[model samples]
Target chain A: MVGVRVDGTTRLMGIIGDPISQARTPQAINPIFAGKGADIVCVPLHVPADDLATVWAGLKAMPNLIGFGVTLPHKQIVPQLCDSLDPLAARIGAVNVVRREPDGRFRGYQFDGQGFVRGLIAQGVVLQGRDALMIGAGGAAVAIAFALQQAGIARLVVANRTFDKAEALARAVNEATGTSFATAGAPTPESGQLVVNATSLGLNDSDPLPLDVSMLQAGMTVAEVIAKPEITALLRAAEQRGAAIHSGIHMITGQVSLIADHMIAALG
Target chain B: MVGVRVDGTTRLMGIIGDPISQARTPQAINPIFAGKGADIVCVPLHVPADDLATVWAGLKAMPNLIGFGVTLPHKQIVPQLCDSLDPLAARIGAVNVVRREPDGRFRGYQFDGQGFVRGLIAQGVVLQGRDALMIGAGGAAVAIAFALQQAGIARLVVANRTFDKAEALARAVNEATGTSFATAGAPTPESGQLVVNATSLGLNDSDPLPLDVSMLQAGMTVAEVIAKPEITALLRAAEQRGAAIHSGIHMITGQVSLIADHMIAALG
Candidate 1:
């Protein structure tokens, strides 16, 4: 938690979600504001799905609120509510953050994919011309898949339990990027240079691995999207096979600064 | 300023007003929450008049919000927007605080008058059967006037620049309490046992006294409603006239704990 001295003049920001007690954005970003001596405080708002529209209208009318972050059940539905969307966010059909403009219009932006890519790059992992195998066709997978393509990946094989959803995501990415760079297929850990577990498989100790750990190659790199355990079973197996590993925590650490910067830049 | 550690689980309360930068509630009440080690934080929300309805809707939908305080232009209009109001608040047609029930209904409560009377009583300035001369007939004056009658004040003389407004307030209080203990009249400093300066005249240094200080006798006690410049010109002159003077800061000090207790009690 951040030590904040909130007063009448302090600017406001928050993360809106249902079952919001588990959200970490407030703890992650409030420290950045405090360190910079910025008079901004980020709190959590537990707004149910039915109340989003009413809450949004009130947020717009708040003169001192700079912006707020969207999470879980809200990312996809929030884009339509935004006054404008970043071109990439529009193409991806999801938004993870929204900034309030001086004219009182809210512009949405997608940072999940960008955060994943930035996290990998910051860790010195190469993405250009790499052949990657991504598991799952959920929201996180969709964002990461597009980001991998944008980062100059030679090809991407999207693997999921429901093959139809995976194929749909691959086709959408290909159509938007104007390249035959994505395909729907089963996860082949031995063949791909990079493997990403974007599913919730690693969240619990009893959960099965998203891919074949035995097929993991010595030179391959395995990454995960489950942040709670930090070292997921899949990543542990991959490391034992002499492969490099990346934890899902980086996705959050990589975006906290970006989220704070986006909201502060709009203040000027 | 209170040092607050804000996280997702912290319950929220705030002060709502236009030009809210001058509100002292946040600074006053947050420390009480922190002192009790309670996971409750009080912030400030600047909601303009036109957006009150929209903001009120949003606040009701926030599951983690316990309640909020209403100030300035909002105090009088908020009662009608409430699902229910304390009988005294409805009678006075004003509310300074509100609590959100678990069932989602918002109930408004008035504490301004109680606070003023409590402040005087806390300092051992007796109110039982006292003859008092109260200046001004504004919102604060109205709350204080009704409270004084409830506290068993023998008689209350309501005075204002506009005589009609004073008469109307006196008539309303008398009718509601079923007592002929209040009247509309000019401020006669020498006649009353207690003199209350409820007008805004004592706010600025260059302004005239709410009543003639020459007639303020040694036995009479003078009280004020202006918190800033704790000792107003009227208070200073009354002190020089050998009268017991009470500063306005006690009103806030007297009510802060009461407000906090009201919101927290509903949480159970």
Candidate 2:
């Protein structure tokens, strides 16, 4: 490339996705990025699922390329290719983070759970000695639920439209950590301590919310993992009812740092 | 990857090379990158010759990928893939550029000759009515000679260890552009106009410079394409004898802006 001035001294990182522009990797990491004295900057790269292998290989061979964030389709695929996979990543059955170490090895880690825990802690949302209702058993749901347990949230109910996935996730977490979990339907603030929505139902203006929050108790806290519409239908509804709401911005912000740290840790 | 701040508005460009970093795409671009009001960043990617077809097809499919710079093996391949090629690009036997049109189509062009020409012009070194001697008949040699002719250089003697390639470059430029080209075996100040070392000589510290300037002419200018040393031995020797000397830096600077313009034009 003519005017593009890359060299061995230039650091490289990227987010690989079919549609790369929608990602928030830039803004969320900006604060810590400025503080870290990092000579690197991450950029977005579009790699369709079908061409993922070839593009991934092409990226790895780049003399200036250090590592990349595996997005969407590549996330699941990366775990199998990595030199090592963090236990939590293997347990969650997905990899939303990947990096190339200084020794030139690619490592995969999942930071969704860790980011959720850190974000919650930052907001002073107490998890210890509390009961949590995790709505939706998909990627983010399982991650949040597992991280809550790690943070000492003693009681958790994993719920989903398809109860099997929720039950499976609960079983996987419970078996892995010996922390007993219960399966429940959509939660009520009366008994559920921390009310979280991991479903895609409230993403758009037209979609219905996961559950009616009018009945939610006044003290019940709410969180949604839908980052695009920072305040999802459920979050907005909870806000109207005067409940504490944690927008997905926290989780998104927490991920880049957590992942960067993991990548650095992996290198050592 | 860290501190990368790509958002929906980021203007995108890419550098295409197998071992990409050796070429300085990012450094050259960053210096002139500010004040554009656009998030213009060029990312480096390695695409090998064998996988270029499919990988390039995938790259074209990216909606945000505005333009790309080609290097090494890809320099010649763009002509075959492009719908049309700039006549100069075809004559030079390679393309170092592929720009996106506003209509989303890409066109191919070559800038090596123009870069060398601009390098000469920028230094205020006159070429009009000057005779020249260029060593090596490779791509860079041909490009520099063509540029020398375009700058109104009157006579040229191309000397290469294997003179056939030099002869071919000379014949092609002459037939294609109607430029006068002449060849000679030995370097003599009486016949020297400008002496350039275009071969892959003078790379390492121990490597002998291809051209000896013991009989250097004061009126002649000396130049070379090898960038690593910044001061090639031939250029140093020529400078000591009062001949004007230009390094690869000016050539690189001259070429970078054209590549950026091509990329922006490609984006349409």
Candidate 3:
């Protein structure tokens, strides 16, 4: 209980995921939720993948539940459940946070995109006129990439184990915004100003490296989207290589605050 | 920003319902969630009836959501959302609350059944050896009738506009609880000692009356489940006739504390 909750006066925020015990949201954002109000609390809800519909019927029935953050598996599914969704959230094809209204309706939003943008700013990394290397083309990676353009990154490259998925995502983002800030390939010859690893690899104690962190260079900013086991192997390796590091924890904290603020505003 | 929330030291509780705004759980239970260092905050989550599966998926994914007092439209549906459900909730064919664990699994329980029993005891009304009259076979009424038997009522007569549903619910409670208190049809000849109106007979300004006080005896006790218009016409009439009355507001308050306690014990 000592480390589980925030002090009084904080508002409430939460992230829902399957296998929630392994999530980092509880540890990273509960404090921030408390910091904002000392009256707030952030909780992690583990909703099963199969019974999503039935449980949802009952959850929305409770008048006291304010809003919730969605995670893997459910993230993509949340958009379809919304009566009306944020344009960006719908375009991103997933939602990491939702705002519940007085009418028992949930409006979906993708905070992860904006959160990462805020993260870059927090670490003094300027996104404008910068070329970046983003590893993986998964949900988190895609969301982060979408957020990157908003932060003014001029050019980008997306590297992944599966070239097709990466290419599809890059093409989608490019086609949607016509900004052409993202691309797909293997570890290529083009150097980048910022490099980010978004895959789950390098997270577990025994997981393999998803990307060549060795490709990182001096003066280049490196970031890892993995929050738990806070210092993933790739991040440590990046640090060892003298690359400036902007941890994903910053993104999580910023996102929690942003999501809570958004929900509060929506509620009002 | 200025309200109670469940943190590490706080407990968790919820009031489950769709269209949750019409319910008043935050007012009744938030104080209790804060009373014992349990940073409980009740949120109003509006789950669309069609998107039930998605809502459940979102809810089960979080690690912090605990118990809840489920409400209208979802009472019957909540039981299916759980991996394990209370027999009483299962028997009543409904659930009003669910308990989530640290591991993120949700277990369903029907607190309305027990809360109603406690409401009777708090008023020093012993159900044992006392004949009772229950009006309506709706969600709340069914729960109250099941609870009455648990309190040792001698016999119960269920009355409803649709007499068949009331008779059916009475039979269901009798079969599942193994209590002989349930009976078909409405109370006849005013023979019941304890009369209860669980329908929305006296709500807002012009709600219809469900019970006829014409045959009420002076020593009999009458209870109403309507929270607003606390002084219901039936209860008021019973009071005028020198009969004791347990206002619906008392039931609402009792249920909130009961649910908060359930969460504290379950989550702690």
Candidate 4:
């Protein structure tokens, strides 16, 4: 899309989140739009949590706004605001991507969990019949937990600062999937074969690790959901203790093409 | 703004109109943004007349949207929708530009008339004490009429398809300027020394001239507000009749810097 200009015919896509200044969606996805030579651009929308309803109404009225990416605090909340949702998004109880139909109806979709799973699988980490331990019961945690189960994980343990939240999330996933493997528990050395940090604890330097580093074993594999630093304290500590480590950037990289394709497919 | 990217921190400005495909504001003012190295980009938003209110609400809620340019049918309607209006905008009863304040309030401003006057003056077409004949009584006509009066024009005859509309616009301008120089009239051979087309008639190829071209004579200066075609039918006819013809692009060129400066000043 060399020489492409932001003219009237250009369609718009935006990523909505609070504290949006640190987002990499535009940098990661806009180039893909250019690569396809499509007259579409992605922008960042800094929307506060309280004003989400107002902003959502406004976005629905924009005929040229194809859709937007959901992140952080918006992912779980936007599900109720959407007109409809795919089964995966509905089951996960979270949406990371949305598409606006021609009739102005917003349809929600979940790609975060699938992207993370694909990223790990692409690196040759098998999830089939493997036991996994995940931190946090938030939006990302819910989506990833469901995806890990769908990927044929044998046993899963959910950990969170609030034990009730972890318990509720585990119960929902089990009920939705008709499985009895998931349960709320604390992080321990023998928790599972796969240790995942689906929390924001690694986003800032002052933040503590999502789980105790001493619990990581030499044969374990650790993964993260925070991408900015590329190397979180947990990942660093896991590496120092000889556990296999995966950076958070791979999750975004794995789904960048899928998101771009889904957004522009209808335009054609 | 060399190598500028549409990242999270980049602020946005847009031109909103129904037929926004023809708008040149993005092409004209985006370079000005780059020249100043401001991380602000202008995009064209194809918002229909019915969706203006919804889009306005959306833009106000967006913390990073600096403002937008108003055009065509939106100019007149947006005045009432603004949170506040400048004296000039209130006087003209229209707004061609808007700035969103830090507190999410939209401030409307008018520059069409001043820009036209400045463009003519820059070209040495003196309007002081001269009589002018303007076509149409819409948003642009009203703005230019008041600007012509403010430029010390001795008389201004406003001609529109609806005589009542012309009369109303003339009455408003005259009362606002505290002068009885502007009045509703028809275009004749000896209407005024300055003949201007302030309507959308010259936009398409098959459209008739706003005024009778046979009335154009030698020594008369014909100007336009339609900038897409540098040489409109009126200007071409005026040129053939040995009259000085002014291109519509000058109107936008005259005020481009003023608009860009006003939009970005508050940001600094």
Index of the highest-TM-score prediction: 1
lDDT, candidate 4, residue A119? 78
Clashes of each: 0, 15, 55, 0
How well does candidate 2 match the true structure in TM-score terms?
Answer: 0.81
- Candidate 1 C-alpha lDDT tens digits along B1-268: 6578888798889789998888888878889888877788888888999999999999888889888999877987899899999998898788999889878799999998888888898999988978999999998899999889988889999989999999999999989988888899988865548899898997888898898889897888999989988999999999998999999998887788778877888878
Note the residue pairs that clash in candidate 4. Answer: none
TM-score of each: 0.90, 0.81, 0.58, 0.82
What would the per-residue lDDT of candidate 3 be over residues B46-115, giving only the tens digit for each residue? Answer: 4555655666665554445565566667766778778887777777677777888556677777767577
**Candidate 3 residue runs with Cα over 4 Å from true position:** A1-15, A21-45, A56-67, A84-87, A100-107, A185-192, A210-215, B1-12, B16-268
Candidate 4 lDDT, A189-240, residue by residue in tens: 4634888899999999999888889878677889888887999999999999
Q: What would the per-residue lDDT of candidate 1 be over residues A56-140, giving only the tens digit for each residue? A: 9988887887889998778879999999999888977889898898787999999888888888888888899889999999888
RMSD, every candidate, angstroms: 2.8, 4.7, 8.0, 4.2
Return the DockQ of model 3.
0.13
The two-chain DockQ for each candidate, comma-separated, is 0.61, 0.27, 0.13, 0.37
Q: How close to the true structure is residue A241 of candidate 4, measured as C-alpha lDDT?
A: 87
What overall lDDT, based on C-alpha atoms, would model 2 receive against the true structure?
0.72
Candidate 2 on B1-268: residue-level lDDT in tens?
Answer: 2123355346667778776657577657644444334466776666677867765665666656777788877887778987667777777768787776677676677888788778777888777887777888888887777787887888878888886776777787777676556654554555447777788888877887686668776777787777778997877888898887888778887888667655654443
